[model samples]
Target: MNLGARHPGTEAAWATGEYIRHELERAGCRVWTQEFSYRGVRLRNVVGVLGEGKGPISLLGAHYDTRRLADRDVSYPTRPVPGANDGDSGVAVLLELARALDQERLANEVWLAFFDAEDQGGIDGWPWSVGASYMAANLPA
Candidate 1:
């Protein structure tokens, strides 16, 4: 559970992405990663599909990236945040739901969307929810 600070464009974030992919596979979902670039830096969003039917589509999303700097912290504005609740908590919930959900009995297709590059907003000309925006723009037809 001690994954350290998983900020975008960091090794910890990449490792965390790999862990999420493995967990999604183990939870009986077909998983994949969607790669995108921001400010010349490559990032990705992890997605897992729980069903293949043509019914409706349901998406469960959470960001996995933490801020590189704790700009909100008065004393440690330059330091990184541990992000236990900022981003990790949502990841935890999504992973648990992936494990608990029954894919076979689902009436609609469920997509577990773990996004990246979402927390470093307004810093260095970055915007919020970059990963989510990319995914939304590139959704399957």
Candidate 2:
């Protein structure tokens, strides 16, 4: 999946979410996405569940949205960040762990949360952690 910039509210970011959903499904997760919108821009938080234990939940999370603007880049502050490490790397680690962790030996339910709209802070008055906040507020009991 060649998700170019993965800025929130962009095609690349939506494509990246779909890619994550596919990866999670391949990793044996029951996957779904929490849909929401920020300032008229649609976003989603991809969630994957492993193990059916009714005990405490062990949640692993990572934000998948890169910054909309590379403010720290002196030469190209208006451009979006590549986020190979900032956003993509965490998703990579989570996918690997989702595939590697043995569900049969689990003590509690595990949740893999791929959050969106997180990295876009200060650009066009956007806020950080928007997807995470939405998920946390509406997580199923």
Model 2 lDDT per residue over 7-114, tens place? 788898899999999999998989988989989888999998888674789899999988878998999998878999999899999999889988888888899999
List ranges where model 2 is wrong by over 4 Å.
none
Which candidate leads in lDDT? Answer: 1
Residue pairs with backbone overlap in model 1:
none
Per-residue lDDT value at 1 in model 2: 61
Candidate 1: count the clashes: 0
Error of 1 at 21 (Å): 0.3
Question: Every model's Cα RMSD, please?
Answer: 1.2, 1.1
Candidate 2, residue 23: Cα displacement in angstroms equals 0.9
lDDT per residue (tens digit) for residues 1-141 in model 1: 577998887788889999999999999889978988888887999998887683889998999999988999999999998898999999999999899988878899999999999998988889999999999999877
- Measured on C-alpha atoms, candidate 1 has an lDDT of 0.90
